[model samples]
Target: MVNILPAKEIYLQGNEHALLLLHSFTSHTRDMKKVAAKLHEEGYTCYAPLYRGHGNAPEQLLQYNVYDWWQDVMNAYQFLLDEGYQKISVIGISIGGIFTLKLAQLEQLEQIIVLSVPVEKEPEQLKQRIMDYAYNYKNIEGKSALQISNEIEPFTNMPLDSFIAFQHFIKDTMLHLNKITIPIAIFYGERDEDVYAQSAETIYQQVQSSKKKLKGFANSKHLMTLGRDQEDIMKEMMEFLRMNNGDLTQ
Candidate 1:
């Protein structure tokens, strides 16, 4: 059961600067926990929302789409603003990073930090991962083999609409990248697929923000938040927020 980890939303209130941390797809809010805790220690309030259809049976994830998660992003941001956190920034990894970029398109965020965001789609890889998640999720839930097959049957054949939604969402976010004018920092791990390296480069080139920085973690892969260089990643994230979050001109 421990092989398929389950997680919950986390909130640690500290100061006026609020950080809305977003997690990756096929994952939970726990992906952002370590960094959120680190930022909270620095007096920055942190909130990591578990998007609808997640943190439950993986079959439930198929019931929702990326648009629903976008609404979750909006709600998470609004929650911070309503809590008097006027200066809110965003940090997202993987699909969460796509949402981060999507938010930056329409919102006046203080800064944006994205990790291992896929500008290009890998359909086969995506399919395998999602199916794996569904299988493991059912397996960990103590479901019988028949029960697992029942829940995973839809995913075993072709791409679901949910998968299509992810593909389209990535393309859609790319179209709006030039609209992001605030400071943005893009990070990718070297051990990840070569596509993510290209993804990092594409995001840096396409974003209209003059204050942009790009770096790669030698010791990290797609899940940079939990990699060997995570501490370095945390320091880099905090420094970016400190440097850009204070600027009122943006």
Candidate 2:
């Protein structure tokens, strides 16, 4: 049986549409709080979902996979639909962004905003180093490098299976990018050491959406939304949402 993660809703007045926000692996909804607050200020009702095994305990991650994450998104989308929200937009960060791209192919979303998505993984040595650090490092607070490394560490100590599953999701999702017709805005950090820079370029080149754009932050790392250029990123997101009928600016 698949366990779909539950979502936490934050309603902001005056927003006619609903926005579904997904965070990166092992992260909670707090990852999108700043972005959600900005969107809320712009009149959007934000629904941030905590993926299965995340924001609770690390051990729970063993039961979750990419499909469970997708299920959580579908459940949240249906909830918004039942709540009378017709226009919907999705914003995902890191692994969440990868799921956003996968969800876009389903044709239910009107617009998508992805930040620092991991469409391509780094080399084997780098991957191993990341896994090792995540497994060994405990005090992550205030350590920017450790925090960034932990984000790509597969969410648990187990390996090979999860890595293969992640790769499958990447390949399968990229193959179906042509099916996504919604307006998409992809943001990346040029200094990101986790995902490949070419991942963004490949997405830009392959996505079938005519209204797609790729934005890169030269100074930021993998956590673009939380980095120094956060304000600029938020501004760009607001502009994109307004242009795409996301109801936040409308």
For 129-182, candidate 2 gives per-residue lDDT tens digits of 334444433333334665645664554345566556666777788888788887
Q: Best by TM-score, which number?
A: 1
In model 1, what are the clashing residue pairs, if there are any?
none
Best by lDDT: 1
Q: State in Å the error of residue 21, model 2.
A: 0.8
Q: Lowest-lDDT window of 10 residues in candidate 1?
A: 241-250
Compute each candidate's TM-score over C-alphas.
Answer: 0.90, 0.81
Model 2: lDDT equals 0.74
Error of 1 at 224 (Å): 0.7
